[model samples]
Target: MLIILILPLLKANHPDFMNMATKAVKRAFLVALIPLLLFLSESTTGFIHKLPWFDIFLTSLDMSYKLDIFPTVFLPVALFVTWNILEYSLWYMAQDPNQQKFIKYLLIFLLTMIILVTSGNLITLFLGWEGVGIMSFLLISWYFSRNDAVVAAMQAVLYNRIGDIGFLMAFCWLISYSGSISLDFALATTAKSTTLPLVGFILAAASKSAQFGLHPWLASAMEGPTPVSALLHSSTMVVAGIYLLIRTQPLLGLNDTALTTCLCLGAISTAFAATAALTQNDIKKIVAYSTSSQLGLMMVAIGLNLPHLAMFHICTHAFFKAMLFMCSGIIIHSLNDEQDIRKMGGLQHHLPLTTTCVSIGSLALMGTPFLAGFYSKDAIIEAMNTSYVNFTALLLTLIAVSFTAVYSLRLMYFTSLKYPRHNVIINFDELSTPVFKTITRLCLGSIFAGWLILHFFLPSNDITHTMPPHIKMTALLITLLAFIIAFDLAKFHWTKEPKNKITSKQFSTNFYPIIIHRSVTTLTMNFSWNLTSHILDLLLLKALMPDLLKITQLPPMLMVRLSQSGLIKLYISALLITLFLAMIPTILL
Candidate 1:
């Protein structure tokens, strides 16, 4: 079945029948994936006691290369990937000449993520980790002609490489202490031995997941195609860090420092990103910052020692996040690539379906009641309230949640409710059949996947269902308050200049993490170059070379002057010296 899905991709470059064939292939693949998902879910339930759904082993240097799939994590990821692939085939890239190449890159990206998530050993995990990094660099730079795309791709690679160092450090510690890189072996070690690796793992998660200090790349990643944004943000690349920490939850549980670190990093990132999202005008960037905020919450869940909650949130976030990006894609496409929300208004009058889907996604994002986000997000917040972790983290998380509602509603108000501000008069309606089907399917998931996953897969005991009514109602109440505040704020026309221009610009610029990062890097490079030039180039090479050369050339200069002089005695003396030196070797022999 997988082979059938991939065969059409190989011939996707043939212009004669490529379009229809690829579309049909994508639909067929989606159809085929349904039964497979159902079968996996049923088997997982029936054989819940059985460990590791599937495994592969290959022997090299007496080490086993193993792959294992845990249904709870892999199922939601598979579903999201399937939907993303279908959406990629829609009208978004229908006119691009390199559509086939883009599709291939997306498939390869998905395959690498699957490998990473299902990896049973550290070596396999590293391979998958590097694979995704490389593929992301390629996909994010898909529009190679654009300077922003190229820069975004480079930024992603450099940031992820920093995380890769952590992964490598962790692997080295595992190999040295445990004599094996297998997850099972690493887990069996003493806490003292695992603490350093856990620290490394946290660093890896921070970099890949875009924690507070390491998050500028995610916002810049909007330079890519929207489908890339959807898949990259939703399930595959950004979440890999959180997934790693979740996979190592048992190890994380044994360490206090690591958990505290996760808590601080997550809390800071969530609050920072949510605040940044509120002041953004670009449609895609608003969603991108929201993704960073959600990932931060996932980290918070990990810190609270509730990996199950984090995993549950990952599953739920994937659906609506992807839907949100696709909806944004449709809007931007319809507007001939206009991305500023200030220029977009009253979309509901023209593209009602797209507007409705975007609203659903935003609501899910803000943790509305019974939606996909509410199930997981509310649980995480509840856990935060009940846990004995940092007080500051809890406060930041709650504030970030309220900020989430504010930004989400604010986004909808400017794009859907206000009078049309865009100059384009084109009638933007529902796109093709594939677009409709993809959006509808994701909308359903955004509504129900969270509840389904929570009820079926996640342990109910972990959720603090018996909390006080005030605590239980905190997220809902905060969301409602935020909606009211945001509505009031929305009444003002966006065209009017803000009174606090500098503050507004700072928030819109993501608090200038990108600026700080570039400034630091530039200063460091300039300092190093200056030091090298002064010490090595000027002092050693330039200052000493003339004297050394003059000293070395003195004998040659004297010989040449003597030869050029109109003096037979000098020539005879030089000839006698040469003959004497030449005869010395013969005499010694």
Candidate 2:
């Protein structure tokens, strides 16, 4: 069944075949969703289908390969969200001549994510993990013409590789300790001290999900197409890290060190990202930072030992975040790719439907009452208040929550409400049929997905019932404050022109792009280039080898032509094939 779904994606390279391929992919996902829903409704327990691909037995241990159902609920979310993103991309990428190629990459991405979520063993999971990393590098750098996109793609891959190493270390520890690669075996193994594996898992989740120190890549990733942003940010790419933490809840529950680490990191990330979002003028960057912020909330939920709540929030956040990105995409296209919200205002007059959709998404993002985010976001906050966490975590989380509303409304004011600052004409009716259809569907999800998740999917409602009156009202009160702050900032634009020099400098220089470049990205890139490009490629591979010396001795002109003409593809293909071959023994032996 999955093979059938993947065929169209792999073959859909021509523009003539793209629409058909996209529809096939969407229908496949929709069809897959039904059985998933049935499984949930039937309250299915344990792995429904297990297929062992092979087995490995060393002198000391035996490990089996298999596929399982730990991410059963997550499968539906992945399918539904991927389906919508595919549908939306048909509209979003309609103008691009290379859209067929883009759709192929997107489908391959979904396939990898599906593999990640359903894999029963750590090894297969990591395979999918690395697969997504590769796909993301391709997708984020899709518009390779842009210098920023190229840099952003590299940053994303490097950051995720840092996380990948953590997963590798954990897998090694688990295989040594438990003598198995299965998740159940690892969880069931009673370790004298779980410090190594637990810490490794935390590091993996933090980097992959863009938690704090490893977070600079996510917001920078806005250089990609908006549909890519919608898919990556909303349900697929970012959620992988959260899903990893959720899956290992039992192990995380065992150690205070790991749990406390999650709490602090999540709290700090939420506050930091929300504050960063408040300062961003780029419409997509604001929403990108919002993703990091909301992801922090999910991390906090995991820290508080409520995996279900985190999953619930993941489902709800998926809808509105995707919608928000789509809305931002529309505005960007309508105004000829203008992303600065400062340049956009009074768009309600030009794009009434998009305006309304963006408003609903913003309200939901801010956790307004009865909206999707309201249901989970409010509950998460209430849980944070009542949990056995320290004041610092609680306070930081609450502050982050307030900032969510501030950014949400700030986006609204700048993009939809204020007087038109530019005399640019927009094609009010440019939305394609498929695009409008997907947007409408997403708006519905933004409005009601939260309530549905809370009622039908989550474990219980008793957590909210135990909270005090003030705790119940905390999200609402802070939201009101956020509205006030948004209105003030919108009207005054204090962020644009701070009275004090120090204040102006703080707002201008402290943003992530500047800070990350100065602190981490530039340093890392230089170090990597020194190690790989100069030390390995130039000296060890080329300079020392006699055949390579002969090649280098070729005329500089001929060498350049040879490299540019066709050798590059052969090299890439050879590298990929070699990597795949190297992994084969690990899987099959």
**TM values, all candidates:** 0.84, 0.84
Best by lDDT: 2
Residue-level lDDT of model 2, residues 1-589, one tens digit each, is 3675676855565556666666666676676666557655775554424555555565222222332333555666666777778877877777888878887888888888877777667766787888888998999999899999999999998888889889889888887787776777778884735788888888999988999989999988999999899989987889899988887887887788888999899999999999998878899999999999999999999888888888888888988888888888888888887888878899999888888999999999889999998988888888888778979999999899888888888888888886787665776584567768778888998898887666556463356456678887988998898788778876777336555656545665256557766867688888987888777777787678965767767678686676565667778987899999999999997
Cα RMSD, each candidate: 6.2, 16.0
> Would you list the C-alpha lDDT of every candidate in the order shown?
0.80, 0.81
What C-alpha root-mean-square deviation, in Å, does candidate 2 show against the real structure?
Answer: 16.0
Candidate 1 has an lDDT of 0.80
Candidate 1 on 1-589: residue-level lDDT in tens?
A: 3354466666666663445444544564465455446645664431211123333454222223332234334544554555555455546788998776776777667667766776667776887788888998998999999999999999988888888888899888877777655776676774643578888888888888988877888998899998899889888899999989987877887788888999989999999999889878899999999999999999999999888788888888999998999889888888888999888999898888888998999999999999999999998998888879899999999999999999999789878986898865865557668788788888998998887776655462445559899988998999899888887777764547778776755446554765788798999999999999899877799768976788788989997776798889887998999999999999999
- In candidate 2, which residue pairs get closer than 3 Å at backbone N, Cα or C atoms, i.e. clash? none
